[model samples]
Target: MRRIVRTLCSVIFILHGLSVGQVKTGADLLFEKYAHLVEGKRIGLVTNHSALLSNGKHLVDAISESRRARLVALFGPEHGVRGDAPAGKKIIDARDEKTGVPVYSLYGQINKPTPEMLKDVDVLLFDILDVGVRFYTFESTMSLAMEAAAEMGIPYIVLDRPNPIRGTWVEGFIRLDSLRSFVGLYPIPVAHGLTMGELATMINNEGWLKNGVRADLKVVKMEGWKRTMWFDETGVRWVKPSPNIAGLATAVVYPGTCFFEGTNVSEGRGTDRPFETIGAPFVAGEQLARELQSYGLPGVVFEPIKFTPRDIPGAASNPKHKSIECGGVFVKVVDRNVYEPVRTGIAMLSALKKLYPNDFQWRNSIDRLSGTPMVRLRIDAGEKPENIVAAWKVELAGFGKLREKYLLY
Candidate 1:
């Protein structure tokens, strides 16, 4: 966290007083600054449905209609351009329905843009909303795009947006190089605090790109935004970055609960309250909730819940524990500032393990999702969540220092 963020702990940062009214996104300020602008360039855009202006017009449309940039082709991330695909589903190349621009799928066989994909492009524009979780593949897509742009020697511009979970709270483990995967690419913590722009700068400056390469990275900084402001405080309408992440509350609990995806438990994927809730058919919801309540974790409470995950088409195709009523817990964040999402998640796992030693299952993916092998190993050895969290302090603090150099706000 920055000194200003720590100093102003008492002040509730919002889009007032310090800021005029609302957060003006980088796209919002496009017309203001014309230096290296996309007004008359061939641009290959990497964006999704959430890249919209305050007026409710999508950036893709606004860019095309403004006649500013000749959108040569479109690049779809993990969920495709319109956010229609399910998690981990591959997207095929197609043409944009509205603009007739050739759409390239970067989430499937082609993890990065090919030379042919960049042959006709002068620059690549990236604009996507991130929910501030490491496992979310948006940042990985952007990193690959940057690498492609660098290899092709084209300038890369990032249209910045607010980190919905704010930019001051850095938590969880710095991913080990051994655990590298599409879900956990860069060595960032689970709830990394930087926005897209700042992370891009870090990715470039820290030489984290392919073969220690670099990009001509340019980040359009958000105006009237601060490191302390959460999405709700920005007065900007929330857009679901992906299918399951539908609300701010879900995002708040996601950094922790999303680990459930690694196990047989459903992380509320097919429920109306995804990420905020987690369960499996074998869980005793009320008993688990009662056990968690005794922990008295800060800024959060767990409530017993019962739900049957649905196999909703387009949203969740074959959800975990599909169509089965499961005992669960709802993570309600009361004061996000004090909440430790990673710890809460670890505590939840600990409670489950202690309560049902034989019933609870620990899948291998837990180590991958957790970014290190220690978390799972320690939990399996009956180590308390606090002790596990305390063990991560040295590495987490080191990452915090390295992260400070790239912060924009």
Candidate 2:
């Protein structure tokens, strides 16, 4: 009986704690209990537009109104695939106006998946929605489409979700393998709290794919996710997974004001509070909100705002101080269980480099969004953001013991 009414709706939300519609995703248990593992085959999916379900539909319209899998071709990542492309635009390969299918562009100029884009496919789903930062490029477009479905041997799967900032809070700094890139390619931690099916089983058991190939992977997990629930305590509705993560309180201060996108300010991208509105144009907003509210940081609070940046077409077209104005501060959180978004983004980059030391700049893309350069050479030697967050506590305790060997929940 639908697995005993989903195990009594997970034991009445673990003894009457029913927070919202009761979580279930992983494309809602892959059409409820792995629809015979993609029933007749030929899938492809690697989706976008926040891949929903639980009746709201859109897992590419339930695998193009499935009988049981046949969705051949359609990929997109980094906005596109009905997600309203904006951040760094560039997606092209069109078609899918409503299942005309054939839509490629793994964020343009190809980012993997090309054996003739998986020659009519067989199995390779993903399902997006991941603001669990680590330079959020949808987990590097899901580890380069699991190394192109392990070089087209197919069977990749992944549909899991919910790490919307709460997988038991692991924090920043650890990208160092010569600063990998594509935002960060691995050695984990810019808040790497797993859950894209435990980071694709820790990028396929830590070999970190490519030239170590693997992907026969499968991960349809999520059923009342819990590595400390958040995503509004899981009821699964907020859909804005990109185009400026506009909800879940700007995704819990986006891994710390997304390090003001490596600087030159305006991390609030073209207004309407993009990363909770930090600012620039030679800031002042009540003395930078009283110097980030005298750093008593803990679950946030900062105010003095100003705003301006325009061209909001499909959300921030020319961002970073586009039509100017700035002056910043708004951050507000108020206790997301002691909100430590990368220590409030390294104390707002050490209070904007100690109150604008001649208008702070630093932009070599902030060491690939701080995957290292020791957090921009220890914040340019002025250190102390708690000793640069205690020099990465023994590499986040050996990545919490190699992330407890690929946690599934």
Candidate 3:
């Protein structure tokens, strides 16, 4: 027991040391470490606009210009190749005017690459920034692509990226298999604390891929990254991973506030502050803000404000209750380490429901976002926020153990 405790302490100390050092992403080391894999081969990349090297060159242009490698095609996730499309918007198959490589839509009529899409490719590479939430579709896209590649006997490589939420915090309920949607494809926690590379290994090894598909997987890892280091700590520039996630501060609050989407409230959508603000036309902003303060949620503070959502394509294209006057609370993350996003979300949700029992409603969509119908059921059943959170402790603890086998850092 003493040995185990000491080992854990040493690992934590090493992780902290790494936060202060300059880190190089997986793509930065590609030419030096694994040029042999891509050199002279027709490669397919599953990536989006957020992917960037430490030196700030986009991977598509880098690989296209590389004399050693031939860029064959591109596969886009929920967003288009350039990541300009909005959520759930169908992306048309188009040509990359920059590289002239045919861009296939993995998020449209076809969710995975057909045999026709893979015939000319020797290996498929997946590299995208993940915000470390289960509902984010990029990880699902990566797993699906891996399955397709596995079935076709093609090699799949994940160019590891940092989990922008930092890898030290894992929270929320484990998803139920019956509730798997594109939003929640696997039975993982909402705030899963793993990098893309680590998640790829877990999904593949744990048989979470479609039909238990076994991937011929390889992960090219980052240098000097630790699970404890957040995106800002990594010394790499932050690119908006998606249209709504505008900054690292927004990403910090997303895991919890995102649940508002499954309800009648506007989750700061259509506003300049998506995910950081929660509002509804029925809310009393000042009173709600005071109530939130009474909860004394750690690592965050709430301010009552009013805003109207605008119709901006790709950002808040058609947000709930758009253009309606909404009295809401804006969240400011002061200290990420102590802010329990899932718990905060649950507490706020509970308070709102209590405050407006007749006005607040949970849509069926909550099951997919929350991972189970039980969370919503428990909340409506008049359970305390702490108890609702506590119900998942056993499973969350079990998942932490299961996740250990696949961690790279």
Candidate achieving higher lDDT, 2 or 3: 3
Ranking by lDDT: 3, 1, 2
By TM-score rank, best first, the candidates go 3, 1, 2
- Which lDDT values do the candidates have, in the order given? 0.88, 0.84, 0.89
lDDT score, candidate 1, position 110: 92
Model 3 misplacement above 4 A: 1-20
Candidate 3 TM-score versus the reference: 0.94
| Candidate 2, 1-409: lDDT as tens digits | 9999999999987765666537898888888788988999988888888897978988897888888778878889877888898898888898898889988988878877789978889898888888777888889989899888888788898988888778888988888888797888888888887788888888887778988888899888988778888888787887888888888888888887888888898888777878888888898889877877787878788888888888888888888778878787888898898888888888888888888878888888888777888877787778878888888767899889889888987
Off by over 4 Å in 1: 1-20
Best by lDDT: 3
Compute the lDDT for candidate 2: 0.84
Clash count, predicted structure 3: 0
TM-score of each: 0.94, 0.35, 0.94
Model 1, range 1-409, lDDT digits (tens) per residue? 7988866864655324454348889877765674357868998999999998888889888877776678898999988999989988999999999999999999999989999999999989999999888888999999999999999899999999999988987888888999999888889989899999998899899998989989999999988898888898886768999988888888888889988877777788888888887888889899999999999899998889999998877788878888899998999898988998988999998888888888888788898789998888898899988998898777888888898888888
Show how many residue pairs clash in every candidate, following the order shown: 0, 0, 0
